[model samples]
Target: MFKIFKLKENGSDVKTEIIAGLSTFMTMAYILAVNPLILSACGMDFTKVFAATAIASAISCFVMGFYANLPFALSASMGVNAMFAYTICNSMGYSWQWALTATLMEGIIFILLTVTNLREAIVNSIPPNLKKAIGAGVGLFVAYIGLKNGNVIVADDSTITAINSHWFTGTPLLTILGVVITAILMVRNVRGAILIGILIITLLGIPMGETKYAGGSFLPASPYFCEFSFSEIFTNHKTLSDFIIITVTLLYVDMFNTVGTLIACAGKSNMIQKDGSIPRTREALMADAVGTTVGAVFGTSTITTFVESSTGVAEGGRTGLTTIVVGILFLLSLFIEPIFGSIPSAATAAALILVGGMMIEPMKDIDYSDYTELIPAFLTILMMICTSSISDGILFGILSYVLLKAFTGRIKQLQLMTWVVAGLFVIRIIIGILS
Candidate 1:
């Protein structure tokens, strides 16, 4: 039975593969909780978001395993969710349903791009330095979110503040402790360290009254389920501009995120060809686009491939089995929210911090040899930290790259598509600023 799904590669053990898949699934289990939380913040129905995530994960995982043949997983996207909540919902005042509709449109656009092989042209046209900058910038932005959400950093009137308190006094302190413990375990090369950290923190929360078992109930009662109004999406023109901006931003972010993740995971899984390219990338992209569209229709934000799945690939997963296991786990979550919800935000915060720390390793890929590269990379990292948006960081990085290259007479070396994308970024920024 295992042979049906297992890779035929020499020296690959089935037992190790299973373990790797489970590890990856555990590392990403936070998504089961985080996805709904983010959508809820956007005033989406929690139940619908949950359903969308499960469906997206199932489709994305199956496609990744069978079609892409790579050890990666896809699900409702994190960065895109943040953009939906912070930019579209908060800044633009779009109803959650309308935001979802925009995401669906973006997903369709992504599918078209993938089908035509434009994804390759677009990715290759990006300067290698800029790509590296985007990766590191996204990592930093996600880490900032982890910190902020964990309440490690709180915003004052004009500055960020850290609450220095004892571990037992509050959840933030507990999160800090959990982060330190998880980091220690990860550095020690312990298997399932992330899951272990979550367990430990959940246990701590239980004792501290931060978590409670929903006695005799299989699923914790969620008050935020399936409450979105699709009619509101079409009727509300007040948020059209916001919807357009978010849709475009998420589309670009999902595109690059999937590209970067596929490349990274392909390298790690040894799925790359001798030329350092992953075959069937278009199929994988199509799967992602489909997943996003499905998610939007089901009432959520964009769905895309997760780079965090690499945490499991690094452990030894090499086939679709890993994603299959993840999908099964996600399906099981519907009946077990109490177990997950019992896990305090502090615990997940720790996991995010640990994951963030691991993600920062990609920074080494940035070419520091050229001043032009270094400046853009630095700007990308800084913008991500300051603006707290991965897309914003990318925009700044690309803009910086184009301006620097143009001034140095190297503009002709860039592709036409590069200039076009850079131009779009400029226009978007101008419109956003003007609005």
Candidate 2:
């Protein structure tokens, strides 16, 4: 086990890895609930989607552990699931099976790209400063999600967003207390501080009515396995055109989302080499591709490396052992649905907020004096928080980087593939405007 994980070389041990895995699972287990609820709106069975989510997540995480040997976890992505339900199925008026077909195609394309190393090339093309910015941007993005989840922030019509007025009571208050508890534990050098905080807040919420136990059958219904709609997509010109657009959009979003997340979590784990590259990147990316394909087969959205994996890396996770432990917990969650389902979002929000704080330490590596680098880097971090999309954050960064370089007579500093990527982003943006 030690030899397979290279635990010593990675500066981690089994105990640490286990704790890290628990922390990560606690942070992301909300996906089990959230994914089903979102997808059910598009006329799929909730319990079936829930089962598929756990199964696909477990498979992906295991592959990541054994094949990629990285401390990362994969699950149905929140953004892509929203697109799958709200855009592809609802707005586009396609069946859920048709959306699954698009997701399958995207995953297959991802596998092909990984096999040819084009995905790796895209990662390599990102400049050092932009990479640092992406890491920090992900930090801000995660922290924002934590705040929103804990009700520390609430949506407002006039101001756009505001602090919850009733934050002193209910879930928000418990969330703040949990943050304090976790912060004190960290300061005192407690192992599994994040995990402990989650459990503590969950217990406290019981008395405050913040945690509700809605018991249900533990057995999951069978998923919509092997259901697809290929002929409907190819029959007519309009349907074919829509299919191409939907597939391309899914491909674009999943590609960059996976890239950004892998970069962020890899940076957190200190796994990126000095040359702005990550080892086993192709294998790790292939794990994501495989996850997406398997998810579609099982009737779910695109499964990719989750940014929440940062929670584990922040807890000293360095090797695949951490990932395997997380996979185990996901499987266990299937039988103990009520217990896992009862874990309130506020209970895990503090851990995410704290991990985000840890992840931003890499920002110091950015070159602050160079406007060409500084502005784009700043925009990357700012837009991630504002737009709540990592891919969009990277899109603006790459576009701005290219524009600034070209206009400032520094085009020679930009790589060829960077230009190509920037051009693609521009085309995607144009397509969005037109459609």
Candidate 3:
């Protein structure tokens, strides 16, 4: 069984592989806590979210390790959670059940696209430059989310406002402190710098009473398990629309995020084919879709692959054992909220800031020779920061690319998918403006 799962490669020791896998999972331990909190805030049952996240993480890790044969781990994606909170919940006022339905539908769509090879083609059709821009834009979007959630930035009447506090005498001081500390550790090439930063902030918050520990005993109870419900999604129209938008958003974000992560990890692991394609891309996508669908039905938001898991891969995880270890740890999570809760947002923020920095490297790959690439890239990055949605950044980027190409007599350069995306972007923007 171990051999079938590639738990032990020809020369690699099983113990060593397990160690590597555990280390990788450690980098993402924050998800166990944060994902549930995000979903709970969005009106999901806390117990259900907890169970769903664990199941999703386990399934995602299993698929990534054994089926997809990558070192990546899957969970409720931070980007997707933000979309569920800000767009689906806040903007659209969709219920949590409706949003979960959307996520399941998105997973189904993703699976179909992957099987038909349409997903690959859409990925290919994106100009390399635009892809790089998408990377940078996603980085900014992730950072923006970290800041917003951490209360570093707040909305104001005329414009967005910065707070003044002890860190700044209420001036986003804690946030600044968190960012600077994380950035310094990252610059020093510290492993787990982000986690460390979060720890520091969390500990500090404890003293200031900014955070409280929920003093509950940890144990895997019946509370954390749920079954999939296809009927809840298929029978409702509002649920259907919610599922469509949220699922499309999840699929799109994961598509690009996974592509970027794969390219980078494959380069480091020598997993890329001679032709420069990452082999098993389809399997990986399928695994991601299945994990997410499973996650939603189990009562979580949306499960997608995590780029941060690459930190563990970079540390020497060479086989599926690493991800399997992650899965085991998640199962153990059923009994350990206190340990996970000890982790602070500051530490997670630090890690996010560091990961955000690492993600920006893809921008260097963009072909700046074409103005078409340059313009769309700029717009994508800017929109991500200002509008605070990774999907918006991507949609705007695609729309900008198509509009520019069409107006400049380069209509042939636009893909059919681009037109379809452009139409959706127009509708979304129109609704956003009207709202």
Candidate 4:
């Protein structure tokens, strides 16, 4: 297996890779509970969704490690899952089955785009500043996820984002301690610092009642496969536009979120080529695409590359071996669900917020002298943080780039597909308004 993975060639070894994998898993293990919490709102079974989350995550990680030779781990994304349950199902009045159907379609589209290299073309088409901005913006987007998940930041009735300090007594207080401990560990260059922090915070939380001991079953029940709702989806002619919007929205977010994360992770690994493509690019994307297709079939939302894999990279995860370890850990979580399920959100939030802070590392490469470049890039970062939407940030950033270039008589600088993408985003927005 060492020879097969070329661990040394990738500048990694068994011990380091194992540590990296464990680090990555600890950081992202929150999805086990979080995915179920959000998806069960759609009336799905909590235990089943929880089981599906781990299974889907494990499958994707194995595919990525064996096939793509990258260190990134895959899981049900928090933002997209919220959109799946809330926007598509509850608000649009579609069944969860219909939502799953849309996710399947999105996965197929992903495979098509990746195989055709249109995804690569989109990545290369973005200006360097915006690309760096995407990385930085993704960092903020994820940190926003951590804050919201940990209840560090609460929705403000009168303002945009207000600190919920009044309710920061128990879990929230522990969350603060976790972040501080994790940050201190990272600063001190402690090995497995993030994972160690999670373990420590979890132990502390058990006494405070922030982390609960939930009962569990030996195994998830049989016939666990969740199928698409194609028949119902196609029959609803009135919701054709809704279906289109939902599919496209999922596709766009998944695509760019994957792209932004790839940039951040690859940038950290020093894996991006001079021309701005990742090595084993097709395989990595294909693995991600397959994970989504398979995950939707198992009754969850979109599964994409987790940016938290960067935490492992920061811990010296330079090869697919790290990913394989993460994959195995995820599978193990299926049977010993009680142990992992006991960890508090505050623990995972610590790792997430710390990893998110590390995501800004790529921002150093952005060219600050050029206002033309700086303006859109800043907007991308701002919109991403403010809207808490990765795709929305990229969307407005592209629009700004196209409009600015056109107004400045620099249309020649823009790529043809850049213009095309900008126009499509505009059209999508317009249709969204009319519908």
Best by lDDT: 2
Per-model TM values vs. the true structure: 0.81, 0.98, 0.76, 0.93
TM-score of the candidate numbered 4?
0.93
**186, model 2: CA deviation in Å?**
0.6
Q: Which 10-residue window of candidate 1 scores lowest in summed lDDT?
A: 220-229
Taking the tens digit of each residue's C-alpha lDDT, what string does model 2 give over 1-435? 999999998889999999999999999999998999999999999999988999999999999999999999999999899999999899989999999999999989999999999999898899999999999999988988999999999999888689999999987898899899999999999998999999999999899998889588877567779889999898789888888888888888888888899999998888889999999999999999999999999999999999899999988999898999989988888888898888887899988888888889879999999999999999999888898999999999999999999999999999999988898798889878766
lDDT of each candidate versus the true structure: 0.69, 0.91, 0.67, 0.84
Q: Which is the winner by lDDT between candidate 1 and candidate 2?
A: 2
**Considering TM-score, which of the candidate structures 2 and 3 is the better prediction for this target?**
2
Write model 4 residue lDDT over 1-435, tens digit each, in one string: 778788878877888888889989988887887898999898888887887888888899999999988999999987899988888889888999899989989999999988998877777777878878888887777777777768888878898877886546876788889999988988898888888998999999988998887668757543148666777866767777688878887887888778778877887788877876678877888888999998988878999999889879878898888999999998888887788878888888877787788888878888889777888999999998888777788888999989989999888988898887787679768867876
lDDT digits (tens) for residues 1-435 of candidate 3: 456656455235566566556645655777777877877777666666776688778877888778866667778887678777767777777666667667777777878878997655554556656666766666655555556555666776777756423335222455567778877876896754554566677677666665467656676544333344456566678665555555655666767556555544554455645444556778877888788778876777677767556555544566666777788788887788677666555445544555566656667766778888888988877887776555666777888899889999999977787687677568666655543
Q: Model 1 segments beyond 4 Å from truth?
A: 1-44, 79-97, 161-168, 214-250, 257-280, 313-318, 430-435
Candidate 3: C-alpha lDDT:
0.67
Q: Locate the minimum summed-lDDT window of 10 residues in model 3.
A: 163-172
Q: Any idea what lDDT model 1 has?
A: 0.69
Descending-lDDT candidate ranking = 2, 4, 1, 3
The C-alpha stretches of model 4 lying farther than 4 A from their native spots are 166-168
What TM-score would candidate 3 get against the native?
0.76
Please give, for residues 1-435, the per-residue lDDT of candidate 1 as tens digits. Answer: 256564665235666566666656655666766888887887766666776677668777777777765667888787778878877777667677567778878988988888898886665666766655665565555566667656777766655555444434667777887888878887898876776777788787777776576433465333223334456655656455555666676777787667666655665455655544466777778888888776766667788887667666656677777776776766776677566556567776676666655556657867788877889888877886786655577677778888888899887867798888788787777766866
